[model samples]
Target: MGTFQIEGGHQLKGSIQPQGAKNEALQILCAVLLTPEKVVIDNIPDIVDVNKLINILSNLGVKIQKLGKGKYSFKSDALQLEYLESEQFKKEGGGLRGSIMIVGPLLARFGKGYIPRPGGDKIGRRRLDTHFEGMIKLGAKFRYNKEERFYGVEAPEGLKGTFMLLDEASVTGTANIVMAAVMAEGETTIYNAACEPYLQQLCKMLNKMGAKISGIGSNMLKIEGVKALNGCEHSVLPDMIEIGSWIGLAAMTKSEITIKNVSWEDLGLIPATFRKLGITVEKRGDDIFIPAHTEGYEIETFIDGSFMTISDAPWPGFTPDLLSIVLVVATQAKGEVLIHQKMFESRLFFVDKLIDMGAKIILCDPHRATVIGHNFKSTLKATTMTSPDIRAGISLLIAALSAKGTSTIHNIEQIDRGYENIDERLRAIGAKIIRTA
Candidate 1:
C-alpha cells in the first residue's frame, strides 16, 4: 500500500479542472453492451474502478481502444456471452456492482446473462434485489447459485415491458431496469425511481439511440420500448462529488479557486448549504469562483436562531457523499454546524481522526454530530491516517493539506480508486503533497 506525505499550512491558489463523472462513466460504459457498433466516450477518468470495469468489458470481448487523452472508442461486437464464467472475468467482474448491470443488455441481446455478486464500497447493505425484481417484472427468470455467489438470468422469449414501482430510490437498480425496459416489447412505467443526474444522462443517451422516454427529470419515467439501440456520442457531466471536494479544499486552505465546466443548474442546494457556513461562492457565467479569504464567515443558525444543522437526503437535497468533506471544512469555519448523515450509519466514525487533530466535535450517535469551527486556531497536529472510504480518504487529504505540519496517509490505493491524478492536480494548485510508498 502506498502512502501520501503532506506538508500543511499551504494556501492553495490557482485553478484545476475536474475529470468526467465516475458514476456516469460507469453506466455509459455498461450501456455499450446494448449495441455492437462503435460507441465513442469522451472525458473518461483514469480511476481504478473505471479501469476495472474496462477490463471486465474487454474480457467479454468489447473492443476498447484509447484514442486520445480522456477519450475512448468501444465496440461491443463479437462479445463472448459465455466469458462471464472465465477465471479472468470472475476475478475482475466478481465484486464490482457496476458489472452486474451488463446482465440487462446481455439478456436482451443474447437471451441469457450471468453475473457474480457485484462488489463496491461497503458503506452499507446494498442489495441487488431491486435489479433482479425489475428484470423479473420485465419477464425474465433468475436463478442464484450460493456456492459460486453468481446470478444467472434467462429471457428466452425476450423481455416484455411492465409497469412497476421500485422498493427504494436505488440508483443502480433504476439504471439496470431502465436499460432492460428500453428493449422490451412495450411501454414500461417506473415509479418512485431515482432521478439523479447520472440516471437522467443515461436516459438522454438511450433516447438519442432511438428509445422514446418520457418524464426525463421526474420521479416517474415512461419508456416506450424500441427494438434496439444504436451507437451515439455523449459527454458525461462533471462529477458533483469532485466539485464539492474543491469547495471544501478552498474553504479549508483559505485559498482563491475557480472550478470550470461545472453545471450550475445541476448543483441543487449545494451553494445555499455552503453559504450557511459563510463561504462565498461567486457565480460568473458557467464557472464558480471562490474568494481567497474567509475570516468572518459566520456559520448560520436555524430559523428559530439555534445552531445550524446540515443533513443529507434524496435528490433536491444535500448529498450524503459530500457531508464528510463538508464536515472537515466546517471544522475550520467560524461557528457551529450540525451534520446529519441519514443514509449511512458508520460514515461519521472518521470524525474521531478530526477530533484528534484538535477540532471541536461531538459525536452524538452514528447519524449526527455537532461541529464547532476552530477559526483556524490551534493548528491541526500531523499524524498518520488511514483511509476508511472513498470520500473520507479525500477529506483526510484535504485536512492534512491544511494542517500545521507533515502527515502521512497510508492505503492511498483506496484514494486512487476514485479521484483521478489527485496528487498532481493538488500540486498544480500550489499544494505540497507527494505520493510515496
Candidate 2:
C-alpha cells in the first residue's frame, strides 16, 4: 500500500484547477451502453474507481481509446453483456458503489442485467432498495441468488414507464432509474428524486441524446421515453466536492489559494454554509480566492440565535461527504461548532483521531460532535493513521499537513479513489508531501 508522509506547518499558496465530477463521469461512462454509437467524454478524472470501471467496460468488449489527458472516446458497438456475470464484474462491482448503474443500461439494451453487491465507503447502511424498487416499478422482475450474492433483472415486455416516488433521495438510485426510464415505453414521472448538479448534467446529456426531460433542477422529473439514443460528446462539470475540500484546506492551513474554473452558479448554499464559520471567500470572475491568515474567526449561531449546528441533508443543502472536512477545519478555527452528520451514523467516528492530536473535541454520539478550535496551537502530535474512506482520508491529510511533525497516512488507495493527483497539486502550492510504498 502507498502512504503519504507530510511535513506539517507550511502554508500552501497558489492556484488549483478542480477536476471533473467523479459522480457524473461514472454515470456518463455507463450511459455509453445505452447506444452502439461512439461517445466522446472530456474532463474525466483519472481516479481509481473510474479506471476500474474502464477496465470492466474494456473486458466487456467496449473499445476505449484514450485521446489525451482527461479526454477519451468510447465505442461500445461490440459490447458483450455476458461480461456482467464474470469475475471481473465481481472485482469491479466490489470496488465501486456506482457499478449498479450498469444494471439499467444492460437491461434496457440486452433485456437482462446482472450485478453483484456493490462496494463503497462504510459510513452507513447505503440502501439498494431504492434502485431495485424503482426498476421493479418500471416493469422489471428481480431474482437474487444466495450462493452468488448477485442480483439479476429482466424486462420481457420492455420497460414501461410508471409514476414512482423514491423513499429516500438516493444519488445512484436516481441515476439508475433515470437511465432505464429514458428508454422505456411511456412517460416516466419521478417524484422526490435527487437533482444535484451531477444529476442535472446527466439529464442534460440524456436530453442531448434525444430524451425529453423536464424539471431539470427540481426534485421532480418528467422523462419521455425514446425509441433509441445516439452517442454525443459531453464535458463534465467541475467537482463541487473538490471545491469544498479546497475551501476547508485553505481555511485550516491559513493559506491563500485561488481555485479556477469553478461553477459558481452550481455552488448552492456552500458559500453561505462556510460563511457561518466566519470564513470570507472572495470571487473574481469564475475564480474563488481564500485569504491567508484569517484574523479572528468564530462560529455563528443558528437563525434562532441559538447554538450553531451544521448538518447534512438532500440536494441544495450541506453535503454529508464534506462534513468530515468541516470537522477538521473546525478544529483549527477559533471557536466551537456542532457537526451533525444526519445521513450517516458512523461518519463522526473519525473525530476521535483529531481529539488525540491535541485538538479539543467531544463525540456526543454516532451522529453528532462538538469541536473546539485549536486556538493556534503550534504543535499537533503526529501519528501513524489508516484511511477508512475517501472523505475521511482527505480530512486526515488536512490535519496531517497542518500538524507539527511528520505523519504517515497508509491505505492511500482510498484517497486516490476520489481526489486526483493530490500530492502533485499540494506540492504546486508549497505543501511538503511525499508518496512512499
Candidate 3:
C-alpha cells in the first residue's frame, strides 16, 4: 500500500491548476466506441480509475495512441468483441466502477455487452439498476448471472428509442442511456436527466459526432436517434470537485491559493455553496482566488437564527462529492454547521478521525454529522489514519495540513484514483506532504 506522511501547520501559496474532470473522462472515453473513426481527446486526467478504464479499452482491442500529455487518439475500427466474455476481462473490468459505462456503447455498436460486478469506493449501495433499466427501456434484453454477479445487455436487432422518466437523476446512469440511445431508431426522450457539466460535455460531444441532442443544461433531454456516429475531438472541463477541495484546503490552512482556468460558468452551485460557509470564493476572470483566511471564517445561520445546515442534492444543489470537504472545513469555522450527506450513508463516518485530532464533531447517524468550529482557539493534533474514499482522503489531508503535528495517512491509492499527482501538486504550493511506497 502507498502512504502519505504529512507535516502539518503549513500555509500554502502560489496557484494550482485543477485537473480535468475524472468523472467526465470515464464517459467521454467510452463514447469512442460509438464510432470507428479516430476520436481525439485532450485534457484527460492522469488518475488511477481513468487509467484503468483506458487499459480496459485497450484489452478490448481499441487502438490507442498517446499524442501528448493528457491527449490521446482512439480508433475502434476493429474490436475484440469476444474479450467481453473472457475471465481476464471480467477481472479487469470488475476493478473499476466506470467499467459499467462501457457496456452502453458496446451494446449500441456491437449488439452485446457484459460485465462482472464492478468495484469502487466502499461508501454505500451503488446499484447498477438505473443503468441497466435505462438500456432495457430502449428495447434491450437484460440478464444477470447470480453465481458470478455479472450483468449483461443484448440488442441483437438494434435498439429503438422511447421516452423514459428516470427513477433518479443518476449521472452515470443518464450518461450510459444517452450513449446507447444516440444511435437507436426514432427518438428518445429522457426526463429527470442529470444535467451536471460532465453529462453536458458528453451530450455536446455526441452532437459534434453528428448525433442530434438538445436540452443541454436541463432536467429533460431530447434526442433524435441517428443511424451512426462519427469521431470528434473533445476536451474535458476542469474538475469542480478538485476546485472545491482546494477552496476548503485554503480555508483550513489559512492559505492564499488561486485555482486557474476553472471554467467558472459551469460551476453551477459550487462557489455560492462555499460562500455560505463563510469562505471567500472570489471570481477573477474565470479564475477562483481564495485569500488566506487569516481571520477564521464563521458559519452563517438561517435568518431565524437556527444552525446552518449544508446538505447534498441533485445537480444545481451542493454536490455530494464535495460534502466531505465542506464537513472538514466546517470543523475549524467560528460556528456550528449540520452536514447532511444524504447521498451516501457512510461518507460522514470519517469525522471520528477529525474528532481524534481534537475537532468537535457529533456523528448524528450514518448520513449526518454536526460539526462545531473551534474558531482557531485550539489547533488540531495530527495522528495516523487510513483513507476510506477519495473525497474523505483529501478532506483528512487538508485537516492534517492545518494540524499541529506530523500525521500519516495509509491507503493513499484511494486518493490517487481521483486527484492526479496530489502530493506533487500540493508540494509545489508549499504543503509538506510526502508519498512513500
Q: lDDT of all the models against the reference?
A: 0.87, 0.88, 0.94
lDDT winner, 2 or 3: 3
Among all candidates shown, the one with the greatest lDDT: 3
Candidate 2 error regions (>4 Å)? 294-296, 377-379
Q: How many backbone clashes does candidate 2 have?
A: 0
RMSD vs true structure, all candidates? 1.3, 1.2, 0.7
Model 3: colliding residue pairs: none
Candidate order by lDDT, decreasing, is 3, 2, 1
Which digits, one per residue and each the tens of the lDDT, describe model 3 over residues 312-401? 999988899999999999989999999999988888888999999999999999999999999999999999999999999999999999
Residue ranges of candidate 1 with Cα displaced over 4 Å: 294-296
lDDT of 1 by residue, 1-437 (tens): 88999999889888778888898899988888989888888988899988889988988899999988889999988998768877667777875778988888787777778888878776766789999999999999999999978888889999898899899887888888888888899889999888889889999988887788999878899999888789988888888889989988888888999998789988888888888888998897988898876473678888898889899987877888899998998998888999999988888988999898888999999989999988876667788899888888998998998898999999888789889999999999899998997
Model 3 scores worst on lDDT over the 10 consecutive residues at 343-352
User: Global CA lDDT of candidate 2, please?
Assistant: 0.88
**Top-TM-score candidate index:** 3
Candidate 2 structure quality by residue, lDDT tens digits, 90-131: 777867888889888887777788888889888989879999
Per-candidate TM equals: 0.97, 0.98, 0.99
